[model samples]
Target chain A: MQVVALSCGNGGKEAQDFIHKVFMPHLQGFLTAEGEDAGVFEARGALALSTDSFVVDPPIFKGGDIGKLCVCGSANDVAMQGAHPEYLSVGFILEEGLEVALLQEILASMQAQLRLGGLKLLSLDTKVVPKGCVDQIFINTTALGPVLYPHLSAKNLKEGQVIIVSGAIGTHGAVLFSQRAEIQLDTPLVSDCQQLYPLLEPVFQSGCKLHALRDATRGGLASVLHEWAQSSGVGIEVEEDCIPILEGVRGVCEILGLEPFMLANEGVCVLCVEAKDARQVCALLQEGGAKKACVIGEVVAGRGVTLKTPWGSKRPLDILEGELLPRIC
Target chain B: MQVVALSCGNGGKEAQDFIHKVFMPHLQGFLTAEGEDAGVFEARGALALSTDSFVVDPPIFKGGDIGKLCVCGSANDVAMQGAHPEYLSVGFILEEGLEVALLQEILASMQAQLRLGGLKLLSLDTKVVPKGCVDQIFINTTALGPVLYPHLSAKNLKEGQVIIVSGAIGTHGAVLFSQRAEIQLDTPLVSDCQQLYPLLEPVFQSGCKLHALRDATRGGLASVLHEWAQSSGVGIEVEEDCIPILEGVRGVCEILGLEPFMLANEGVCVLCVEAKDARQVCALLQEGGAKKACVIGEVVAGRGVTLKTPWGSKRPLDILEGELLPRIC
Candidate 1:
């Protein structure tokens, strides 16, 4: 089987041949500037630029791979700023002796995600390190897009703003944790890794005033809430039973003693809108295929996040404090 | 000494503490968007976007480290496109056991470079992998700049154009190779790693109608010439004696059986200008501190690069065919 060699990343004939023969075919139409040191494009407005590096172990996960996660993660970050992602700059660090077929599969996955999000690949770079210098692969993607709605800051959250979650949380984190720990479940669990722009586009178009928007990524839903509470100096009160968690994911969380709220979610986004527009925004997200979209909490005139248990007890929801999982993306 | 722990990158309270206590102090004023997922900025006119991942082994070398190289390399790529780098999005992938003090030093280096280049840190992401998953650290920098001079491309090279090198070649590659191979040299060698924008700014202001501009990185002088020749379908003939090589670097190259032309340079740039403007461009670069700036070759009506020896023999210079030195950048 063909595998990547150190020479492929040497920036010589071998590197050129590798790019042309292996990468270009999969990303032919999306790449705007293939050979230039940098890609030049026209930009004339307020732009949101976000970057993320994906180092998920077992690069190929249940429902997605590192390639898709890299693209989706950055795109979602940009989209959370109420922007329409338009371009991407990606850098790939590969380990020598990695299977060429696996690399191709990842590239193809990235291409598919780019097409889905209507983002053009503006610039790309690839480097190969010796075996064991890096995990199988690590991808860093920087995304840029024009802002459709301005002033979507966590500081904009006011008391009485409703918090809505686009979908079930913790699936992505649960799937990766299970895969790494070799834990099997009665029901298969897939990551909720996907682009968020398409789902959020209609809300932006509806002219709804979004106080704050954030994808519950690394530190998950609880982290986003805590940040919003701290940044806006407001209290976030959520009903524990109202937050959606998949059955299998809940089982995994129970088995692993992981809090579902603290687990990562690539496709789930937390939104804060005025109470008056809460239902409308949730409806728009649901129409955009976020079937589980619903309002779960509200911004109150206090500090920190509080969870109201179904059994009539309230507890503070602090940010994640320890390492839950490494390289969960 | 405190070292990077897996929890520091978990995007939780510890991650926040790490950023606020460690990273933010070093990068206080330069970071535009500290807490936001992505930074929002106004960009107008044509823009150049470039990305590069620096995995230079040892992380720290004689004259520079991965932090400085990451900043300079991406900024130089944008500058080569006749753009003034204005913003950067950096992603740091750190190993679990990396020394926090070393990371602080690297961040300081990055801040220094950013200040030197007059660039702002727009967005940043940090991820920590488990031990052995990554070599100490790898940094990915994505640079964005406004295009000051448009239409500078490798395809713009034409017959009769003269090639001007900003400085000596092969120092970076030689330094890295010697360090990795543990070769003892009588004379110490340092990498020629610096921001090229400052040196080339005067040339852009001169309005010399530059045909092409490229940093002689990765595969070095020979690779740049080969790319230009193939892209513009012209022949480049260089006088061997005209190409500048530091004495210490030349000795290292001879001992290692490596061609200096194929070695990498971080700070050096190769510019293609009209024959009439070659001397003026060289003067401007020399005035800007590239004291070794000189004309090394000229474009001709043929294909590939030819090296004319001082002994009166001509030989073709091919693109680097194999791995000369990995992670030289």
Candidate 2:
């Protein structure tokens, strides 16, 4: 049994050898010469930076593994700010006895995701804790990219701006719940985990005036709307019927008595764009693979989010109150 | 009993409220607006990037806590590359049920460390995992700084280059062992956990011809020398009698059957400099409060590290093997 020994994470000869032999080869063009304590690089202009820690259970998921989630999560965060994913730093905390082969598999997945965004892995740090100290592996990623769409702040959202969701909501959260829940549901449900840079790049380059863009990771669509509304001091009226919810996700949420709007997402984003360019942005999103992209609602004068149901009833959608789900990311 | 509720880490309204009430006030001028998916910043020129995941057990240690360790560890790596630590992103993985007060204390320690390095916290990601998933808290910090020393590499070492240790060795490892072991030693053995930028800034500003610089961290002094020797493909000869080891640390090592050179040191660093400038750099280091700074070795013509004993005998110093100590970071 080839296990990741405690010595490999002890920052000793074994650790150094493991990194050089196992990690370095797979991270070609991503690693610099091993000399200085830190990797040296060049950066200029406005940079969009984001960091996320992935502690999702069953790191290997239905649609994507933790490695993919780590890369896509941070990259999408940067992309949501209208930046081209460029440089990233990866940190891994592993428990002793983890299989080296499994770690390699995760790294391969990470490499694949990095290739998708054309991002360079600038640095990596790995630590191994005792077997019982941690359940398994946790990954943290910090990314830096040059700003492509500048000054797109939530405060920039004005009354009458159209709201657009790039894809079906809550699929990622649904996948996690289904995988964790003992009761197996027969559904074609998988996480909506993929790089958003390709899909959003065209929309950004299309010169659509994007007022605000945020990934609906935790707290989902509801949280993003509430945050935008509060920050911009503008009321956002979201039509409940307009929100796109995948049937599989709806089924999972129904099983768990959870609302799809409050579930987490990995690659999906919510955009507040000029009302006139909403159709064009939605079209670009759809053409670039976000088939479910659509206009959900518009910003209005007031505070907080208002959800208008299909029957013409209005209700306030506050930020999800409690720990709806832990480690969903 | 007040604790860091799961909801605080759930990425919902409770999490948002916790961040706003607890974190934002302390991180003034560091956090950007709350709506964007990522933080935006400006940067240019040669940037030194480093990331470290601090899993120091008993997170609150004698001299410092894990938060302090996380900040200093990453900052030191950047500083070793001759960079002034500037922008930083912190990621926290909190095990559910941790006390909010304890988390606050750790954050306070982090704040103090950042102040010492004059770094700006660019972004922060917090995740709450179920109990037992992680031990209390783990912090991963990624830092970027402008290079103050253009090129510093272990490969730059040459024959006759002098080695200078910034301070006493093995204090940190000894402290950890003492805290973990049931032995009650009367000696005040505290971790040598402090920022090195202040001490090294003078030496760098004095125009010393520093060829290679590395902090003797996990695998300790022996591993650092072996790494330098192998990386430069040159032999290193160290006078064992001259290597600075604290008396308390030696006592702890003797009791634990561990070698002082194999023990870690948080604030200490080893530097290879031009022979003539060695004395000058040592003097500057001492003036900067590293009073124990002195010449300990020199790069030789062969490979591996050769330690010269007082009895006129020489021996090879290989990289430390096995788990000498875990979670000593």
Candidate 3:
């Protein structure tokens, strides 16, 4: 049971050995610069850059680990800007005594995710703190890419635009909640932790009039709608039945007394497009592997998000206020 | 005293409030993209990218805090590549109970450092973990800039090249060591934590036939020499009397039984230049504010580093093998 030591992060021989023996083998193909102060790459156009830090407890989860989350999370942010995530810079903060095996597993996961997304690893850094200074591990990633479609912003949402959700929501949050030490439920729920760029690639190529694009991650669909409403100064009305949710996720949400709309989703995204292109965008997303893609709502000439119930009632969907779950990402 | 709460990182209204109230006020002038998923910037040439995570214990230190260190550290890495650092993306992992005022102070420091470097804040992310999951805070910064001088690498060192240190070494390490809880030694030494680009600007403009350039950071002068020796398959020999060391730093090193050369320096840089241009380069550095800049060593046709003593004896200078100090950066 090899464990990480303080010497591994001291920028000495031990650290170099750790990088060559442990990290390089896993990240061999993706890394372009091995021992330089910085990595050099050509960037010849408008670039979209995003940064994220993943501190999720129980770093390794049912569907993915923190390493995979770090890569996919930042990639998704870049993709939401109508860009193909091209390169990444990663930083790791490891707690001393963390199992080397666990770190290897996480690194392998990150490598796989990077390969899937066609992202090059430009630079990397590691820092080890004493035990109890941090959890087992935390990962920070910065994703950069060239923008394909410009001016896709939350403020672009207009009154006649329609909202489309790529897939089912809340599975990631539900899975994380069930995996908590206090509530280790025996369910077959896996997180929807994945990259969304591939699914959005065809849509970007199709020349659809994309008004706004965003992945519903931490505060989920509800938060995205509220933000869109506020940013664009428009009202959002969503059909309760039109929102997609898995049975297992709904069950966990019911058991925990949580709102499915407010739960996190890694793979799901909410997009706003012209009303005429709604069907085409949904079809494209479904063909690109988002089987549950559908139009969930539309924008109106008011403010705030509203949920239209099947029983002929409406309720305002407020932005998440109190803490629902910490380290949900 | 308000403290960061879990909800402050939940990507909800509370998170928005925290960003607007706590972070934005300090970082207002630097941040160009405020509410977008990713920041879009123009990158029209070869770019140097670097990433680093700062977890220095005692977030606030004698010379600088973790916030300022994060900014300067990444910026210096980019600058080492002969790049003028232009943009930065920052990620913060905060403990749930960390004081908001302390975080504000850290952000202010970061803002000041970014201003000093003329670097724009492109993107930012914050993640708050539960109490005890992390120390007070950890910051990750990714810096990017257009490469001005290409092909400056450790592998470029060759025989007949001379090594010039930018300033006195080991002050940063000594300052951090004296501030440790176990060793609260009363010392006036301050961490040499600063951005090196401004000082290097004139040298870059002069174009004095540079071979290799690196900031002696984590593992200090010894580590840099050893790396350059191994990378270029050349031998390096430095005179002990020629190496500049502050009296206070030398005193602390003697008391702690640590090699001054193995101690870290944040603001100092080691440069390999043509032997003929060494004197001019040193003069340029001195004129640019590195008052102690001097030729400390020269490259030879062999391997490893050797230290020449004033008593007419030579000894092998090994790379730092064990942990000298943890979290010195």
Candidate 4:
């Protein structure tokens, strides 16, 4: 039972050994664990910065673990601003007695993800708390990157602009729910936990009029649409049929009596682009590995978000409220 | 007792309302809580970046709360790199049933601390977890700043460099211990929780040859000294009697059989300066409110750290190992 002891994060010798043995090998370019309190880096030009703390239950999940989620979460946030995710600072709050092997596995996953976008891990802090003080582990990540396009903003959205979803929605929320419920099923659901910077890089370089981009995360696609509508002071009508939903996600949502529209996403993003560039942007997204990218709806006068069914019926889509699932990241 | 419900972090209408009523009033200038996935900022030139997650037990202490600790902890790290602490992103993980009033109080403390450095709260993420999952509250902060001096590093230390203690040490650790133990001491000790940027700005601007700077946190002064000596492949000799330790902190350490050198510091920093410029740097620090700043040691040709006692005896000051105190931040 090679587990991390309380002394490792006591800011002492054990912590230094853990960094040398576990973290430093993976964080080659990052100046973390350098005995210095902070990591030094160089950045030039306009930058987008974002921070996220991942407290996902069951540190390890199917297809991905908390480590991948941590990277994707912050990197995606920067990418949503049309920035290339470049550098990140990571802080870990580990529960005492956690297995060393588990921590290593998560770090490997993080390294793999960082390599995808050529992102560098710049700084790290590992704090080990007493048992029962925290769950297994919580990771906080802050990402900084040069802004590729300065014009992208929700406030820039206007009437006639269209919305495009990068991929299938609600897979992350559904997979976590099913895993927690322990409902043994043959479908074998996996979380859609992947980096989106690669997917969006081509679209950003395509010279398309990207108005506003947001990762459909906690509040799902509906939440993002509602926010954009409210911020832009315009109504957004997303067609129910055009929105893509995976069969596994749909099945899990159906059994759990959850609305796929309100489910969280880890890898999907909603793009509000000028109406003329909608088709070209979708094509670029699809070419860049966003297989299901397509125009879902358009902006209109008024406020709030509305969903129209295939039969032409329309109704308001409210924001998801309350704890859908605690520690869902 | 108006406590924050789990719904406050569920990314719903309730979370939105909570942000509008509680966070927005205080978070002026930043476009956070705007429903976007991340906040955008402008930056150029070399940037210093750092992150820390504060999980101090007893979130509120005599001089500051976790919020203030969160901001100072990260800002100090960036400042230690000779950078101007500029933009910060905050993430709060709240336990269900935690009082909203306490949360607000902590945020107020954070706001006050930020005002000291002219730092902006650029982004914020509030996640509410189920009760028993977390202990009240844990805050994670990430800071970014322009590199004011690019040559400052632990590796820059050389022989004949004098080390200066910015102020009295060990008060923070002593205060936390007393409060946790519920001891009725005649002297009421407070945490040295102020930001360090203001104190160091003068020294940096005075054109002193600042070799290396480190805030003596966690494993305290001993840890920092050991790290600097080993990193620079040099030995450091300190006069034990010359180190500034407050009377109250000395009392607490003596009563608890602890070494003041091993106790953590929240606001103090240690500087390694060229021997010729030590006096001028110390004078500037004292003028800038670090009244007790003085030469404690000098870097030498050997390795490790040695403390010379007032009795004309020398002994090794090994790295602080084991659990000094958990959640001391």
User: What is the Cα root-mean-square deviation between model 3 and the actual structure?
Assistant: 0.9
- Could you estimate the TM-score for every candidate? 0.99, 0.97, 0.99, 0.97
What TM-score does candidate 4 get on C-alpha atoms? 0.97
Q: Tens digit of lDDT per residue, candidate 3, span B1-329?
A: 39999889988999999999999988879986889989999989899999999998789999999999999999999999999999999999999999999999999999899889999988999999999999999999999999888889989988889999999999999999989998998899999999999998888889688988999998999999999999888999999999999999999999999899999998999999999999999999999889999999899988889999999899998788878878887
| lDDT tens readout by residue for model 2, B180-297 | 6455455688899888888888888898899889989998999889888888889999999999998888888888898899888899999999998999999999999999999999
Interface root mean square deviation for model 3, in Å? 0.8
A235-301 per-residue lDDT for model 2 (tens digits): 9999999999988888888878999999999989999999999999999999998999999999998
At residue A91, give the lDDT of candidate 4: 92
What's the true lDDT of residue B263 in model 1? 95
Looking at chain B only, the TM-scores across the models are 0.98, 0.96, 0.99, 0.97
TM-score-wise, the better of 1 and 2 is: 1
TM-score of 1: 0.99
Deviating ranges (above 4 Å) for candidate 4: A29-33, A181-186, B29-33, B181-186
DockQ of 2: 0.81
Candidate 4 residue-wise lDDT, B269-303, digit = tens: 99999999999999999998899999999998888
Lowest lDDT 10-mer window, candidate 1 chain A? A178-187
Look at candidate 2 and tell me the lDDT of residue B261.
Answer: 90
Q: Which stretches of candidate 1 lie over 4 Å from their true place?
A: A181-186, B184-186
lDDT of 2: 0.87
Ranking the candidates on DockQ from highest down gives 1, 3, 2, 4
Q: Which ten residues in a row have the lowest lDDT in candidate 3 chain B?
A: B318-327
